[model samples]
Target: MTLADTLKGMIGLDPTAHADADMKAVLAALKELNPKPIEECSVAEAREQPTPADAVRKLMTQAGHAARLPLEVEAVQSEDTVIPGAAGSNPARIYRPAGDGPFPLILYFHGGGWVIADLDVYDATPRSIAAQSNAIVVSAHYRQAPEHKLPAAHEDAFAAWRWIVESAASLGGDPSRIAVMGESAGANLAINVAIHARDSGLRAPLHQALIYPVASNNIVSISYEENRSAKPLNKKMMLWFVQNVINDEGDLKSPLIDVVSADLSNLPPTVVVTAGIDPLRSDGEKLAEKLRDAGVAVEHRNYQGATHEFFGMAPVVQAARDAQTFVSLAQRQAFGGVPLEEAP
Candidate 1:
């Protein structure tokens, strides 16, 4: 088996056939670049207040161009669904989905290095996932960094999750069938939510879907060194984002920011998706290993050729579709046993 194929076998998960060409191409491309180690990267910077509207506009514009997937999923938009949040901040958002009878819900955190993302910009992608998984997807608008640091995003994540658990019924969702999902920095938040749920005495999600997650700000993993300059989500951008998100070195060491070394014993079933060409690939792999070692039911998928943020590019890539299928199946299997599955 090729290296990617070998890794899949090691984890007891299957590789999607669509990733074949992409994986091969990416591996070849990386060999040509001869990337530097993650340690060579600089520390992430602190966040600062700027006109965020311009940043949001640019990202949404890029997403619009990036979104080539046809609108095949039925969807609805919601605004300002409140959740108890940290001091002076009440997290809220827009939700989207199809079907009416208590669907599985996804409490989604958006990626913008944890400093720039917003609901309106990421609405379509969550809407797609919700439709594909038949889940009610809530796009959480959390406190951005530079102003809010490590614990702030973690706090908002927990609050939103609690809100979903308590108010799932009103949103036409089954409280027992919720999942937490995100990409890049948001993926880190989703993983944090899962960890917190298991440790905080709160209701745990049925599943956790992490798309090219950032499990550490350290960037010491093999993939980080190998794909430091990988397009879309590079190591520099990652370091910059982390620097902005953490309050200081101590905060950087917090379990919420450093998931790789964090205790994984209580996390729920998880599906971690990585791109063969992405720097964060090793983060996802290592997390899956840690979770499995901790006796959690975890599945890892590495899509070749696709690159970072492939999950959001479902509009044009077959790999993204296959991933959605895999996650949907996993979500159903996880919730199938809950007593609430039979509730009204």
Candidate 2:
């Protein structure tokens, strides 16, 4: 038996007890890879850890499927551009669908706890979103932490949104129908951009889709307690990320960081997605409740048997596929138009 199997046998842990069948399979395959625990690794080592996509690609290769790193979707055209930011210029990639008059725009942010990962590591999501929703997708890359620190990524996100709004027409996107969407830390930025736009009297997003967002700094909620040891994201790993991003403890309470404390009034219609096995699940739930209480239209969905980082694993995880469908449907309804093609 593998070391992971031996460990499981010794601990009497059943994979199905916490995750769905497909997720169990993923976990098993991942365990066989014998990756080092993030908590015990240095920042560089943690950053080099294999992502779920990497593991899935390996599994597929082992199963006789062709290995395709950074899965691609057929967008009619894609271009990379640089957007000016407070610190420096940020790189952004825009994806346009085929035969588009002026498609609705989705300003997408990728998740990396505001530190690791980048547009290249998360190419599959925006590609899939652009193809599935037939919208112009601008995937933005922001400055990371321990070098740039907290609030830098947030500022870069708002700057990217502003740039998109100002240049939407040139990008073949309708400014009036623009939306903000992201996963994990990117989701935090998406909501913050909406709030910033509303407060700044700029053109607010028509909608915001946040997938497994980091909504609050309080990590003692029931979900956190239950999933503190969850793979991909755990409490210890989160603490490491927090330490790397924030300058000090005081930043934890900032409204931009602790979104539950932020004024949610008059924000755009919102959809918050949560994973059943993620520590941040309660964060999403609390943020949704706060948005609704502030009189904003809100839709919250918690996918059972899903774990953190599952949002971008649609190629392997059924729950992720379902979540992606939910996100695309929400975007379509918010954009107030039929998709260029029906969502699968």
Winning candidate number (lDDT): 2
Assess candidate 1 and give its TM-score to the true structure: 0.76
Q: Write down the TM-score for model 2.
A: 0.90
For 227-318, candidate 2 gives per-residue lDDT tens digits of 76788677778888889999999999999889999899999888899998888999999999999999999989999798888887777777
Best by TM-score: 2
Backbone collision count in every prediction?
Answer: 8, 0
Model 1, residue 247: what's the lDDT? 78
lDDT of 1 at 2: 71
Give the residue spans of candidate 2 off by over 4 A.
1-16, 64-72, 75-77, 339-344
